[model samples]
Target: MTPLITDPLQPVFVIAGAAFCVCLMATICSPALTLFSQILASAQKKVFYDKFARQLATMATTLGVLCFTTMAAGILHTALEEPALFEGPLRLPLMAALGTLTLAFALQVIYSLTWNSLKKNKALHRLFGLFAGLSMFTAVFLSLGLKRTVLAAGLSIPSSAPALDTFLAVYSIPAQSVFWPLLAQALLAGTGAAGALGLCYLLLRREADNYGRDYYNFSTAYCARCALIPSLLQTIPAALLLWMSQPVLSPFALENPFVLLWAAGIAIPLLACAGWMIVAVSAAPLRHKPAMITAPVLLVAGYAVQMFAALRVYALI
Candidate 1:
């Protein structure tokens, strides 16, 4: 069938699915990286790195399972609805992929638990990561493929796709016409993005050690500052897009496609540039032993953006 995304509800599926996939990718790949780092550390006879790697592997695995569960739940929830949470030729394929991801995540969790029970070593962690990687890769691919088509059908995506004209057309409204519910949805979602970014940062030091790469070492001192780099890179755009689109702005804006497109188009590059600059600064060569001081400052800045956007949206609503 021609994979045409038409329903207004399609954006929800697109956004949720994409978010799940991205989170899943991080969860899966992180463990493998952790395991690899452990091996590197072991070869160098570095106990600290090795221990950190083991802990990271376990944490990554556990978190992966949680993210997978959340994504799976989202997919299942969308799939089982009567009229269908979304309609498109790709829907079935997307559902099937999500189902597969769910199974992969479940299996990885089981494998990690078993490995942890058996022993604590690079081998066990590596094995678990290998399994998770398979699922993560699949989720990432599916998400990338479905993103534009899904959003074009009126779904949410990172503001990276071609401008969404038709979708915006449906939600067109004067700024003054926006309403409470619309603002609430935008604010809540944006706030969620900000919160998620914060959590991701707090866990970064542990996660980077999992990679056990020279870069990982380079990243350590900056951990305090660079911790939220990845999550911030991911979240800022989504939050801004939500703010600009004002889908909940009002009945009129909710039905206009142009505003949605404008929001997304503008937010994408801005966030990307901002994320890169922050990460670059954080990753810069420095002799700081503890990452605490710089990291906190950067994190606060990132979180502030999210908080401000959410509040602004709320006020508008």
Candidate 2:
């Protein structure tokens, strides 16, 4: 087997998968982000939730569209390369994932286009985002299920288990228990990125006298609180994934196809550091520390996780 990792077109997989990862994060976080932005008032802060919502919607929609198209192409290419990979019972799950993705794209487009025009109808706009978010969540849940099954197929696990039993067997019981939390990791990553960036913007606004220190502090604490628990809880699912997938993945390479695991290792601590600084800066009343120190680290590490996960999904080095 030629290492698919080294294929010339692997970069295409990287780019497409990277975009898709962002799409997943954005889609999952869109509703919360939109609502969070709305709760923040310009009078009390330097940012306008509607403006932030617009930017987020634009990003999510554009990426969602690209992901929808690119994944379609990528799937076709991979299926053609290895027809058996998609045959038998596997097609059902893959098709479900694809169908979910296609529907998400349409919802995203409609949501994005209506952003400006639907200013008066905030409820409907939010409704679109909410549906899209749920759809995106469903799509990702199905996709993760598919990845486990794919790994099982790649490892050629032999068993007399029922059709779906092979998948459950490969993915693991304890690991599956943390399914929603594992999924929430993406949401945490998304919120961390948005909150950290928004914090920076607000800090800059404070220096510019556009926003008050109190508002900045409040917002910092708010964002940190939103991300901290999920970041902490992610350790469970991360460990589960590493443990469960190791036996299946170890045969594929020498020492390193688990870049996603490595990235998660780096991120978990950075997230802790960032969370602490954010707390000191925003949550701590006695003494506020410099949040700027850890914020960038968190963003970079979070992005690394996202990037590594994309690479793993595409089997790209």
Candidate 3:
């Protein structure tokens, strides 16, 4: 089977897409962590804000900008390359995605910029963070639906009858079958990225900021624990996605050496990172400095391998 993309720019798009995914996930998850800190560690809210949430908010803002820029560029590229793609049932969803993304970005900026001013009003500020995360998740949901619509188009599936039906279809079971698994994978991947990034940030600041070992310990443990839940649970969705893909790629997966390599590439680092995180969280004083440094590198490697493998598979199909 021929690949889906034949353009010379395919590599660029793939890289950009992967980066955009990471940025979007970070954008969504950062604020979520902020909200979690606000709610769960309310007593330590000041320390959390000073040490973690504040920086996370800034990172989320920067990532939100990158996500918006990349998404807009992608949309424009698609519109220019294949105008007909937007003329079909995907138009509504596309519009919804753009709107949601814009709203998310705006909310993120407001949430970040108002941090100092809103310090006195924690309730309102947390609401802003919560809404920002929700809007970003909605954008992701609509984008995924748009992707499914494009795939359905390729398969010659008919568009829904009602003008709004396609938009609403995402709420149905069949749509959810696709959505849920992807969502799980995303949460797993996103939180992994978040944890890795958080750890890296802490490592960089540890010496220069002189925040004290106690602060670093708490932050490191916090980030690892946040990522731990998703890392452990990711197998369920990973298995589900594999099961779903079997009908299409079963033979390819079994026969192709590269597939096996890529699968291993995805699993091993993730497991190692998860195991390291467990150790980091369980140990007194959170001692794994090397793991803190390497976690982000491992995550990027995993994402890179996953993207390459996916692109290769798409090419063959």
TM-score of each: 0.45, 0.60, 0.82
Please name the candidate that would achieve the greatest TM-score relative to the true structure.
3
**Candidate 1 to truth, TM:** 0.45
TM-score, cand. 3 vs. native: 0.82
**Model 3 per-residue lDDT tens digits across residues 10-75:** 666665566567667867777777777767657754575455777667767876677778768977
Model 3 segments beyond 4 Å from truth?
1-16, 43-46, 80-88, 153-162, 170-176, 206-210, 252-259, 271-275, 282-287, 310-317
Query: How well is each residue in 242-262 modelled by candidate 1, as lDDT tens digits?
Result: 555456444336344433443
- Pairs clashing within candidate 2: none
Clashes of each: 28, 0, 1
For 1-317, candidate 2 gives per-residue lDDT tens digits of 32434566655655555444644564556556755565564345645445555555665565556655676787889899988756654656677778887787688778779877987887788788778777766777777766755654355644444657654554453545435555666666655444444444445445654445565555556555554544555555555545544444545344454544444553554655555454745444214335544554554555455445444544545
The runs of at least 3 residues in candidate 2 whose Cα sits more than 4 Å from the true structure, single-residue gaps closed, are: 1-24, 39-47, 83-87, 153-181, 194-233, 239-317
Runs of candidate 1 with Cα error greater than 4 angstroms are 1-26, 82-88, 116-125, 153-317
Q: How many residue pairs in model 2 have overlapping backbones? A: 0
Query: Model 1: how large is the Cα RMSD against the reference?
Result: 12.9
- The best candidate by lDDT is 3
The per-model lDDT (C-alpha) reads 0.45, 0.57, 0.68
